[model samples]
Target chain A: MTPQELRLACRDGSFTTNTSGYCAGYVQANLVILPKSWADEFFVFAQQNPKPCPIIGFSKTPGEPVIRVGGKDVDIRSDLPQYRVWRDGELAGEPADVSDVWQDDFVTFLIGCSFSFEEALLADGLEIRNITEQVNVPMFNTNIACEPTERFYGNQVVSMRPFKAADAIRMIQICSRFPNVHGAPVHLGDPSLIGIEDIQKPDYGDAVTVNEGELPVFTACGVTPQAVIKQAKPPVCITHSPGCMLVTDIPNSKLAIF
Target chain B: MTPQELRLACRDGSFTTNTSGYCAGYVQANLVILPKSWADEFFVFAQQNPKPCPIIGFSKTPGEPVIRVGGKDVDIRSDLPQYRVWRDGELAGEPADVSDVWQDDFVTFLIGCSFSFEEALLADGLEIRNITEQVNVPMFNTNIACEPTERFYGNQVVSMRPFKAADAIRMIQICSRFPNVHGAPVHLGDPSLIGIEDIQKPDYGDAVTVNEGELPVFTACGVTPQAVIKQAKPPVCITHSPGCMLVTDIPNSKLAIF
Candidate 1:
């Protein structure tokens, strides 16, 4: 379906599943909703740690639900298939629609997700192990610390994909074109060097096979914000449910600077 | 000295030393002069294996001593600081000027050198182990074979520089912009993976320190042509002596596509 159609299905409560393969060429974004009081500090956090938390677009003003930056009819409340409500760093609820808990002082941020660059990679004929294995991309917490703000700060979280050294080089070149979506990989080759203790056991997402002759290439993950927000322990925060992203009208190709 | 001044000094039999540090910011090329009878096959060889034999420019016609493509007054016979005269694939003499050996039916080819990209890496603050250790960049014969023509067939020769994974990634990005100068690294990480049994014992050039956290990044080397020439056993071949290159008027920045 088109991005608009998929988003409309989401708005009417007919599409509660994850929006991964629904809007193929369109941009899918990780969502973060915060109060006006905490939004400025969070913006600073994203600015300082752009590789992990690149902000593609945010609400024009506090309490503004319509994200005209991505699409004309994008409603922050009902456009996403699912959202995780955070209360004091805890998972309070997983709701399909968040209009009931919407606050007048709410600010929504649309973060560039890896899905965009993943599509670019697949289009260039590179195999994504997570897609082939039918699992979420393996993600790990790294010792590489993110630049901290007054309220939000944490170690960087990275998602992994395995490729032979040559293909890994090509992946880096292709992904480098899309700076909005984490840009090039942060690390490859040795995982222990980046403080990832075990390759088979990820802190988040299902582990895929890292076959012999392959290097586990890591890119800064959008989930970093969720991890940071959890550590920061904001009184009220919201984020997209895992794998359930906001389908934007922006085409994935549009994100590539080159 | 400017590239032209250096060329003038070489032409006048004054500059007999290597051109490594001379003519900064300008292109330095590996010189290959072949008999007209052998030039066509070698051209095909270079076309099929650009990574190792990227032809920056060539004589306009057989017997042409001037290369107008890179500079206004580049005389192929004496523009380089030194030339290696090869008789039946064996080095006959290393001469400051090749005016005595200039042949009417000779075709001069200027192949891209790694020095262009090495300068780029240094400017970007990436440490080149060879430059820091004051030795030649280590080179290895890889199992990675070049696409061959009838007369020219051999495995690729790669120059190595050790860098931490992060620096290696940056090096890849920077080198990619200058495709004429070997482009991005051909392989990184394990040396044995590419059939090099000993990382410390390179087939050509000097081995530098590979620090604990650094990966030995490999780029296709211009030395591959010299190796191919040795194997092909051309009746009469000429090349730039090791570390001596043809300094051209082309600015290094002009080679960057982006």
Candidate 2:
């Protein structure tokens, strides 16, 4: 389906769940909307740390509902299927549409997500464990710290896939081509080193099987910005409810810097 | 210096040592010349395995001194600083020039070498340990087997460097750009996994100090082909003397596919 068609369904509340497996070949983004007071610090946070928080689209001025980078009528407030409203570092509600509560001071952000690299990996014939198991990619909270802005500070979050030694090398190469989509893996083998005490238990997403002789490869994840923003505790923040993404018209190939 | 000028110097016997650290921005190649009887099998072997033995230039016809891909006036017999004459796997002699032994059925193969990526790493401000220590890069034989032809079969040979985990990741990404030049590392950490019994006792080159927290990163070495050639024990095989490469006018940047 086209991004516009998907957005139209989302706007009318007909599509109200995960954006995965929809709008194939197009870019899918993580949505972040914050009050103007906190947007500047978040931008600085993304600049200081790009791999985890690659900003693909952003609102130019406060109260701007449309993000032209994706479409002429891309309304951040109503395009996504679900929105997570956070108040003072806590989840206030999970709303399908935030237009009723939208404020004039809101600024939208669309950060690049792993869906782009996942597409690239699949194209290369590499098996992404989470996809094979028919579950969301397992994500972990890691000990690797992100370069912080004064207000935004937190440990990095990484997604994992299991591959044997040789496949891990190939996965690294394929993913490296899409820098906007978290680039190469942050760590491989020995989850403890990255501070993930248990490979079987993920903080987010379903845990997939890691077969014998396979190493779990970890990449910087989209959940990082969400985790960081929560710790910062801005007065009011809105982000895509988990797995609900802003599907854009851009093809995944466009993300390749080469 | 221009490739033509450098060739003129080598032909005149003014340049008779390792061709590295000179011809700053150009590609340096590993030379392998074999009689026509063995050339076809070796070509298949190289094709079967590109990462360890990427062929950058090859003679179109056997016994042709002309290397068409390298340059218009390039002569295989005299451009390299030194040549090693191997007689049934034994080093028969080392000569400054091989024009006397040049035959109508001899084919020249210019395989990619690691010097290109070392130059790239240095340009990226990553310290190449061997260059920093002013010593030869340490090399070892690994359990990883090369795809063997009828007569050519042996364990893989790898060159080693030490880097912290983060720098190792960066090195992998950088080296990946130049596939012809050994490409990215074959393995990192736990030498026993790849059958390198001791990191300190490399089969070739002097072992430098691997810092306490640094991991030993291994890359498929150009020496693998040479090692295979040695094991095959061909009646008449020739190679560039170690460190004495066939410097081409092709810039290292041209090797980067991206």
Candidate 3:
């Protein structure tokens, strides 16, 4: 479906599943809405940790309902398939829409997601195990500390995909073109170095098959910001449910720096 | 020294050692000279296997002694520090100068080398183990077969360097910018996957430290053409002695596409 159609379906309560594989050519973003008091610190955190939290679009003005930069007529409150509401870093509710809870002092940010890079990877004839296995990409919290800002501090969270050495090299080259979406891999080979205790056990998301002779390639993941938010414990924070991303009109190719 | 001065020094036998670290920012190329009879097939082989045999410049005419494309006044016979003369695919001699053996039908080719990319990696503060250890980069003959021509056929030869996963990713990025050199790495992680049996014992050059958390990254080596030429058994072939490259006036940065 087109991004507009997907957003419309979402608004009408007709589409409530994960947005993965929908609107294939358009960008799908990780939605993060915060009160104005915490937005500045979160923005600084993203700037300092670009790979995981590459901000593609943000509300130009606080309390504005529509996201003007990332897509035309993109309503921040109801465009996403699902929203996870948080109160003092605790899970409050998983809502289909959050328009009722919208605040005048709230700010919305659209961060780039791995889906775009995965599309590029698949287009290049490389196999992504998560897509093939029909599961979410495996994610782990690493000991690699992030450059922190006031009220925002945590270790990096990385997503893992397994590939043979040569394919991993090609993946690096391909992903390098899409920096906005966690460009290139941060680690590969030994999991111990990154504090990932077991390759088969992921801290978040479902673990996929890591075949023989394949190395687990890890990229800084968007979950990092959520992980940081939990640590920061803001009075209120809202994000898209896992895999339930905000579909945008912007073409995925537009994110490529090359 | 400037490339011109270096060439002059090579011509006069004032500098007779390997040219690995000399003329820091200039492009240093692997030299190959073959008779016009075998040049056509070798040229095709180079084109087919560009990562290993990236041809930066070649003689405009078969009998021309001076190379004008890659650098100025580069006399094919004496511009390199040392030359290896091969007869019927056998090593005939390693000579300081090949001016006396210059054949009218000799066609000279300057193939791109790893030195250019090494300079790039170093400039980015990444350590090159070979440069740090003051030794030649370890090279291995891989089972990864090369696309062959009628007169040339062999497996690829790759040079290995050890880097932590993060540095390896950065190295791939830096190398991708210089495709004229041996672009990005061919294989990384398990050495045996590429048919490299032992990481510690390389087929050519000295092995450097592969630190505890590091993986061995391999790049298609310029030596691949030399290995293929050996198998072809051309009546007469010549190449720059290992590490004794032909320094060019082209600045390394000029090769970066970005």
lDDT (Cα, tens digit) per residue for candidate 3, span B34-121:
9999998889999999999999989968889889876888787888889999999999999989888889999999999998999999
Cα lDDT tens digits, model 2, B1-258, are 787778778888999988878889888899999999999999999988787899998998999897978864888898889999999999999998999988889999999999899999999999889999999999999999998899988888999999866677788899989999988888876788899899999999999889876778899999999999998998998899999998888989999987
Model 1 CA deviation exceeding 4 Å by range: none
Q: Which pairs clash inside model 1? A: none
lDDT of each: 0.91, 0.89, 0.92
Error of 2 at B240 (Å): 1.1
lDDT of 2 by residue, A1-258 (tens): 789999989999999989998988999999999999999999999988888999988998999898898774888888999999999989999998999889999999989989898888888888888898999888899999999989999999999999876677778888888888888888876788889999999999889999976778889998999999999899899999988999998889999987
- Ranking according to DockQ, highest score first: 3, 1, 2
List the candidate 2 regions with Cα displacement exceeding 4 Å: A190-193, A198-201, B1-6, B66-73
DockQ of each: 0.75, 0.39, 0.91
Report residue A35 deviation for candidate 3 (angstroms): 0.8
Q: TM-score of B chain for each model?
A: 0.98, 0.98, 0.97
TM-score of 2: 0.92
- In the range B95-199, model 1's lDDT, one tens digit per residue, is 887878888889989999999999999999999999999999999999999998888899999999999998999999999999999999999998888999999
Residue pairs that clash (backbone atoms under 3 angstroms), model 3 = none
